[model samples]
Target: MIYLQLFLSFFQVGLFSFGGGYAAVPLIQNQIVETHHWLELSQFADLVTIAEMTPGPIAINSATFVGQQVAGLPGAILCTLGCILPSFILVLMLSCLYMKYRSMKAMQGILAGLRPAIVAMIAGAGMSILLLALFQGALSHIRLGNFRVVECMLFLVSLFLLRRYRISPIAVIFGSGIVGTLIYTLLPV
Candidate 1:
């Protein structure tokens, strides 16, 4: 029953998530954090941190992590499948339709309309994560001084390096993890 729940929850997220992995975060949070109460808000933050630090899409990572946390390896496999199934089926069907409608003006217009909606969904997901982080960091009893500043610096540095220098993501994750460990050791907690 727990495995079924994990699969269904992620299946719903996969079905409605239109703008890629980040766009699925809020929906997953709503399901796992709010609806099921399987994880606390702080745990959700940790999930996001772990997801980002690992390889793969954020949505898949979240599904696998949450499922494993809730149940075990079986839950992880089911949730991962649920997360990807919609995209697999939708893309296959759409590819066929796209090939058939290659010269159709109406189809082209529909595709154009979808672009902005997808962008909006992605933006909403990002904002949701940011709001959660800010709210938690501000309201927590053990708030760290200048934590937001550190977050902003890391975000900016990451964006700059990825966009400008095209650093490999694996390199960034491993490098940052080492740097973060060193910083934690050096800085006063």
Candidate 2:
């Protein structure tokens, strides 16, 4: 029953979460944390962090982690399958339609319209994560002391490296990780 629930819940996420994994964050949070109570909000945030740091899509990683926590290996497999199936099917169908309609003005216009919505969704997700990281909880519980100065600094430096110096993102990520580790170890808590 738990496995079934996991499958269905993630299936819903896969079905409705458009514009890729970042756009799926809110839906994932709602289904896994709020609706299903499979994980606490803090745990979900931690899952997102781990997911971001790891390879593969954030939504798939999240489903696997939550499923493993809830129901072990079989749960992980089922949840992952559920999360990917809809996208797989939709992409197959959309690709066929796109090939057929590739020259149509209406199709082009629709694609153009979708671009802004996808961007907005991704931006909203980024803002939510930023707020969560900065405040260390929901907005109502926000405290200045909870803000992570080192993280903000790392972000700024990483942005500078990527934009101004044109450094690879993977290098920036590894560099930030090393810097963060050194700061935590050297600074007295």
Candidate 3:
């Protein structure tokens, strides 16, 4: 019963979560943290962090993580299959429709309309993650003075390197991890 529930919960996530993985963050949160009560907000934030750091889509990674946490290996398989099913089917169907209507003005207009919505969803997700990171996973702790100066500086420097030098994101991520580990390990945070 629990495994089935887990599958359905993530199935809902995969079905309704449009605009890719970043945009799916809130929907995934709603399913796992809010609706199902499978994980608390801080745990959800940690799961998101882990999902982002690992390979593959964030939503799929999150499904696997949550499933493993909830009901172990079998749960992971069910949840992952559930999460992937809708995307697999939808993409197959949509590819056919898209090919058939490749030059239609209506299709172009629909695509144009969707672009802003996707951008808004991604921005919203980014802001929520930023708030959680800055506040240390608790919104109640939010204050002007609570910002981690070193962490914020690290983010800024990483962004600068990526934009200015066109460094690979994977390199920036690994470099940031090493820097953060060294800093936190050496100094008292």
User: Whole-model lDDT for model 2 versus the true structure?
Assistant: 0.89
lDDT of all predictions: 0.82, 0.89, 0.89
Candidate 3 residue-wise lDDT, 1-189, digit = tens: 999999998888888778999988988888888888999888988899889999999999999999999999999998899898999999999999999998999999999999999899999989888787666656657888778877787888999999999999999988988999999999998
Clashes of 1: 0
lDDT by residue for model 1 (1-189), tens? 888889999999999988888878889888998899999887988898799888889999999999899888998999999999999999999999999998999998998999998888889877766655544442334354534554555566776888999999778767766776777799863
**How many clashing pairs per prediction, in order?**
0, 0, 0
Candidate 3 Cα deviation (angstroms), residue 109: 1.8
lDDT agreement of model 3 with the native? 0.89
Tell me the TM-score of model 1.
0.81
Model 2 CA deviation exceeding 4 Å by range: none
lDDT of residue 121 for candidate 3: 91
After superposing candidate 3, which stretches have Cα over 4 Å from the reference? none
Q: Over the stretch 82-181, how does candidate 2's per-residue lDDT look in tens digits?
A: 9999999999999999999999999999999999998998898888887776667764588888887888888888889999999988888789889989
Candidate 1 segments exceeding 4 Å error: 131-147, 163-169
Best by TM-score: 3
